[model samples]
Target chain A: MKKALSVIMVVVVMFLASFTVVRSASAEEVKITGVITKIEMAADKKSAIAVLKDNKSGESVTITITDDLTLDKFKDHRIVDGDEIRTKFEKEGDKNISKMFKKTAGC
Target chain B: MSGKIITIMLGCALLTTTVQAKEHPGKEQILKDGYQGPKTCEVCHPGKAKEFLGTVHWKHASKADHVDNLNHKEEHGMKNRIYTMCNGNDIVNNLKEIPPNAAGKTKFSGCNTCHPGDHTIDVGSTGPEAEQSIDCLICHSTKYDFRKRKIVKDDKGNVVMTQDRSTEAAANIGRPSIKNCMVCHEAAGGGALVKRGFSMTKEADVHVSKGIICVDCHQAKNHKIPTGRDPNNWASDGIYMTCVGECHSEKPHKDAGINKHTAKIACQTCHIPRTGGAFSKDFTKWEKMSNGFYEPSTLKREVNETAPVYAWYNLTVSNTPHFIGPKGSRTDGKSKIYPFKLFQGKAYYNKKDGQLLSMDFAPPMATGDTLAGVASAAKILGIKDYEPVPGWQTIYFGSNHQVAPKGKALGCANCHSVNGVLNLKELGYSAKEVEKLTTPEIYFEKLLKLQQENE
Candidate 1:
C-alpha cells in the first residue's frame, strides 16, 4: 500500500512538469518586421495573404488574413510595396503569428 | 428701177449674214471644243491666277478634274464616270456620283450655271481653255486687258478690264460679301443656309450681333474637300466650332481648372446645353438665373444631379500578450501571435437609390500598410474593424450645392459606426474607425429625410 502511494505521487509530479513545458514551448512570442513583398486573395475572396520579409533578419514570412478583418477604417492610409511594418506574434499550435499593430509608409 | 433693186438686194444679203452669225454651235461640238485652260489666262493675269490657285475653290476644281486640259485618276478605284448636279458636289465630289447617259459625256449645263463659261469657243494650246469656263475672274474682277496685258480701272473704282460674270459676284467688285457664303449655307427657298448669320436677305435687316460668316469658323484654307469616301482619301482633321480649337481657348465652364488634371472628361459633360445647337435649352440658364433672379427659399429643393465619387479605408489589429502557451514539458515556449494586416477597396454608390453599385478591391500591396502581413493574418479570423457595408460602400450620389451639386463626400461614420448606440459604437470600434467616424458631422436628420424619400 505504501509503495503504491509513492509511485502515484511520482507519476502526478511528472505529468505537471510535462504540461508546463509544453505550454511554455508552444506560447513563445515571435517578432517579425519588414516591408511587404506580395499580397494575394483567395479564389473566393474569403481570405487574403500577405508575404512579408523581416527588415533586420532578412527572413520572409507569410501572413494569412480572413475576410472578417474590417479594413475600411484606414481609408486614408494608402498601402503599397516597400512599406515598413512591425508585427508581434505567438505560436498558435505550431505556427507563430499575431494580429498587426502599427504600419507606416512614405506619404 | 436699177438703183432701188440694188439697195433691196444688199439689205437682203445683210439680213442673211446676221441670222447665220447668231446661230450657236451644237452641244456635241461645244464639248469637243472644250474651254481654254487657266494657263492661257496666266499669260495675262499671272498674279491673279496664282491667287486663284491658292483658293479652296480652285483646289476643289482640281480635285474634281474640272480643269479642261488636265487628266486625273480617282485615288481608290473610284469610278469618276458618274454625273452629279451641284457644282459644290462636282467641284469637290463631296456627294455620291450619278449615272452616265448614252451621250458618252456628262451634261454639265446645270453645273455650269454656277461654274459658268462657254467651253466650246475658248481653246488652249493643248485642248480647250479651262479659264474660259467661268473661272477666277467670275468672282474676283480684274483690271488687266488680256489683249494689251494692261490694267484698266473704271471711273467708279471697278476693275472693268475683267467682267463680273458670276451670278453671285458683288456689285462693288472688291471684297467677297457674306451673300457669297450664304448662297449655299442659307436655307433653300429663301431659307438662311447658315441660320446663325447676321442678315436676313435685306441689308437693313442685318443683325451684326447674331454671329459672323461661315469663314470665321470653317476657315476657308482648311476647308476639306472630299475627293472620295475611300479611307485613304478621308479627312483626318476633325471639325471644330468657334467655341473650340485655338482661337477661343476659353472653355465654357467656371471649373475648367479640373480639366487640367484629367482632360479625358468630354466638355459636354458639364456644358450639357452646348452638346446640341442653339435650339436646345441653354445649360447656362441655371448660372444666369442664380446670379440674381431666383430667390432661395428656406425649404431646401431637391435636384436630380448625379456624379461619381471614390473613398478608401485601412485596418490594423492589435492585442495585449496573454497566455504564453499550453503547459506540457521541460522546454520553454514562446507566446502565440495572431497577425493582422490591412486590405483596401473602392465602393461605388448611386445616390438616387441610396444603393451601392459595386466594390473594387485594390491589390493588398497597394494599401501601403506596413502591418499588412500581420493584419492579413487577423483578417482571416474576422478580427478587424469596418467590415464591408452593403448599401453604403458603393453608391451613386447627388447634392444640393448648385455649383458642384453632386453628393458630398461620404462620412466615415456611415460605414464604421455601430447602429443606434453612439458611445458604445465609438468605444467598440477599432482605432482607425474611431478616428474616421468622428469628423464632418452630417445633418443626419436631413440625410434621413432625403434617404427615405429616395427609397
Candidate 2:
C-alpha cells in the first residue's frame, strides 16, 4: 500500500509540473514579417492604414497607425508580389493575437 | 418817320424772338410737363418701354408704395423701411401719383435719376419716348449725344450716345450707366444695406469685383422688378434659387461640382454649422429641409446631460449635489486613494468585459470625471445602484480614455496585418458585403496613387 501511494503521489506531482510548464511555454511572444501592400489616410489626416502580407503564405492583413509610422519603414524590404516573410504572434485572447515582425528580407 | 420806326422795330423783334426760341426751345416746357412720362410713348414703342421697365435702372428708385408690394420687413434699426425707393419727393410723389399709397412719404430724387420710366400717365403728358424713358433710339440707335447733350443719329439710323460717354456723365445727364448699380451695390455701401441673415459679410465685394452686373441676374418685366429678395416682386413667374445665379453657380468647390439638383438641398445639409450671421455656429435653423420636411431620427440631439462626478478617498465631488454611490477619498483621508467597488453592474478585471459594459452605458470617462466618482455619485443620486460583482479590478487613468472591444484594439493582428495587406473577412466586412466591392487592398492602393498624383 505504501509503495503504491508513493507512485501515485509522484505521478500527480509530475502532472501539475508539466501543466505549469505548458502554460508558460504557450505564453511566449511571437514575431511576424511581411511586405506592405496598402495604405489609407483618415479624412482629418490623423490616422492611416498599412496593409502587409506574409510572403510564404501569401496571406495579407491590414493595420491602422497614427502619424508615427513613415514610408521609410517599408523601403528596400524586398516586398513584391510573391516574396516570403516570417512572423511571430502572441495570443492576446481567444479571438485576438498581437503580432510583430521577426525579420524581413528578400525571398 | 413813323413808318420807318415801325418797320425797324418789327424786324428786330422778329430776330430776337427767333434767337430766344432756338436757345431755350423747351426747357420751361419740359420742366412744367414733368416728362410726358413713359406711358405716353409706350403707345408707339410698347415693346421697348416694357423691356426698359424690367431693367434694374427702372427699379432703382420706385415709389415706396410700389416697393412695399413685396413681403419684406426691415431688420435691425431700419424697421418697416423698404429699400427699393429713394428718400426724396419728386420720385416718390411721381410713384405715389401712379400707385397711390395712404402712408406715402414723398421722396424719390436719388433713385429716380436712373429708373426713368413712368408706370402711370397723366392725361396731358406725352408717352415714354417724350418722357425719355430709355428710348430705343438712345441705346440701339445710339442717337442721344450724352456729352454734347444733343440728339445724334447713328450709322444704323438709330439714336445713341457715343461709346466714349462717361457712365457718370450719362447718369448725371439722365442716361443708364453701370456705375449707378455700383454706387450702392458695391462694397462701398451704396447698394442696399445688407442686413442680418444674408451670407455676405460687411466687407465682401466679390459681387462687384467679379464684374457681375445687377441686370444680369435681376431681370425686369413690365413695371415689375425681379430681385433676389422675393418671387412675388420678381418680373418672371418662376422659382429661382439664389445659388443658381450666373456668377456664383458653382463656387466654393472647384471640382465637386454643385448644380441645380444639389442647390435644391439646403446649403447647410452638408456644410457643418457656422456661427454668426446665417453661416454662423449659432445658426441652427438651416438644418431644416428647404421643402419643409423634418426627420427626427437624423436630428443630432444637443448634449445637455449633467457633467459627471469624481470621487477620491471616499469623498465625492460632482456638478450636481446628488450622490449615486460611495464617495471617493474624503478630505481627511491619508492616502487619498479610494477603494472602488462597482455594484449593480458587473465589473471585470479584463478589458474585454469593461469594453462590453461601456458599449451599453456611458463611457467610463467621457464626462471628464473619474469613473469611481461618477458611479458613486450616481448611486447616491438614485440614478443607479453600486452593486459589487465577482470580478477582478482593473485601474485605468487617462482623460477621455475610451475602452474598445477586446478583439478590436489597435495592435491586434486583424487590424495591423504583416505587409499592409487587409483581410476584409476579419473586419466584419463579410456581413456587410463590403468585400464584394473594393477590398481594403484595392482601396489603399487607390488612395496611395491618388495622393502621389495630387502631390
Candidate 3:
C-alpha cells in the first residue's frame, strides 16, 4: 500500500513540473530585418530554418519556423534566398521561432 | 624656422625620388612596397608608356569603348556590370549613356589597375601631380607585388584618396616577363576559366611549357596586340606575331592526307580535345556575406567537368565564330571551322524578357545573393513584375589558351566513332554523313586480307 501511494505522489509531482517549464518559457517576440541567405527544411520534418544576414553588420541568425498554417505561404515569396525580409519571431526556451515574415523587396 | 625646415624636407624627398628612378632606369622602381605611379617610370620609358596606354586595357574604364567592336553577347555583359553599380535614377541614366573614355577623367582610369595608380583617388579631378599617376613597375618589375584596394566610401566619412606606393617596395624594373603578365591576365574577368575558356597560367598550356611568353606572339606595337588577322601579317615583318605557319609548313602533319583537314579545322580542335582534362563543377546555393561578398552556402567549391564543344573561328575580328554561334550551330558561310570550349553554368534569368537579369539573379559564376542582384536589375530596368527562370546557360568561347602536347591530341575515336563527345546528328549532319564519318578506315593491306579470305 505504501509503495502504491508513493508512486501516485511521484506522478503528480512530474505532471506539476511540466507545467512549471511551460510557464517559465514565456514567449517573447523579436523583430529582425535582413536578407534571407538560406532556408532549410527540418530533417525530422517538424520545422524549417531560415538563415538571415544583417546587411549592415554582415552578422547572421537562424529562425526556426513551425507554424504549419504559414509554412507554405511563407515559402512562396519570403523564403527565397536574397529576399530582403523583415521577420517577427518568438523565443521560447532556446529556439528562435518565427511567427510572421515579410518580403519587403521592391516590386 | 618651421616653414623653412618643411620646405627643405620636401625638396630632399623630391630629390630622392628623382635619384631612385634614374638609378633603376628601364627597370622596376624600388618604392616603399608598391609600384610608383606610371609617371615615374615614364621618366625613363616614355615610349613604352605611350604604347601601353593605347591597349584595350586602359579603354575599359569607359564602358562604351569596351563594347565598341565586341559582339552582341559582350555588349550584354557590359550592361550587366553597370547594373551592379547603379542604384538611383541619376546614376542609371548617366550610365545608360555610355560616355567616351576621357583617359584622364574617371576616378580609376582602367589603366590604374596595371599601371600603378591609386584606384581610390579620382585622379581625374584631384589633379594630383603626374608623378602621382602612373606606376610602370607593376608590368615591368619581376618582383612587383601590388594589390588594389576596394573603392570604400561610408556615409559618415569623406572619400579618401588612395595613398601612394608602399615606402618599402623593392624594385627590379625591366621588360615585361611572363610572371608580370600572369599577375593580371591569370585572374582576368575573374578566375582561371574566365574570359577565355582557359588561361596561360595552367601548366598544361602548351605554349607556357614551350618557354613562350605573352610577348612572343603578341609582339606589341603602340601596345596593340596583333591578331594574325592583320592585313600585313608578315611574321618577319618586325611584328612579333606567331601563327601555325611559323612552325608548320603548308602541311603540318606527318601524313599529308591528314593535314588536308587543316583547311576546314582549327589546330586546337585535335590538340586541346579537353580541359581540366575536360571537367568542371559548380555548387548551386551560395550566400552573400556581410561585407558584400558571396560564398558557397555549403562552404565547398563545386566541381563539374565535361567535354568541349566545337565551333568555327575567324581571328581577325572576333574570337567567337559569329557565323556558327554554337557547337550545334551551322556556319552561315561566313566563318571557317574553329575549335572552341563550351562552358556551362546554372543561374536565374527572366524568361519573359529575353534579357539576362544581371542584378537579380546570381550569374553562373556569382556567389552572392541572387535575389538581391535580380532585384537591383529589376529596379534599373524598371520592371514591375520580375520572376526568375532558373537554368543552366552555356557559351562557346575560344579554347586557344590551355593546349596539350601533340602526343595527347585526341585520337579519331574521340570524335569520329559512334561513342563520341559530339552527336553529329545534333550538329546537323545527315544520316549518310554520320554513317560515313563513323565507318572505320580500311588500309590497303587490310582490304587485301579480306579479299584473300573471300577467295
Best by DockQ: 3
CA shift at B93, candidate 1, in angstroms? 11
> Lowest summed lDDT over 10 consecutive residues: which window, candidate 2 chain B?
B277-286
| Backbone collisions counted per model | 87, 77, 32
Interface RMSD of 2: 35.1
Question: TM-score (chain A) of candidate 3?
Answer: 0.61
lDDT of 1 by residue, B1-455 (tens): 23443454355445434433443323233245432434433444464444433333433222322212124453111111111001012212211112232232221111112222232212111122333433443332222112321124446542222333322221113222343433322321111211111222222121111223233334443233212111111111222232344332434333434334123222222321110001111110111111111100111111112221211101111111110111111122321111111111122223344322221111112221213322332343343443322221111111101111123222223332444213323224465665565443533555566679999
Candidates ranked, most accurate by lDDT first: 3, 1, 2
| Error in Å for residue B123 of model 3 | 12
Which one wins on TM-score? 3
What TM-score would each prediction reach against the true structure?
0.24, 0.23, 0.53
- Model 2: how far residue A56 lies from native, Å: 88
Worst 10 residues of 1 chain B by lDDT: B275-284
Model 2 TM-score on a 0 to 1 scale = 0.23
The total of clashing pairs for model 3 equals 32
- Deviation of model 1 at B353, angstroms: 53
Q: Report residue B454 deviation for candidate 1 (angstroms).
A: 27
lDDT scores for all predictions? 0.30, 0.29, 0.47
TM-score of 3: 0.53
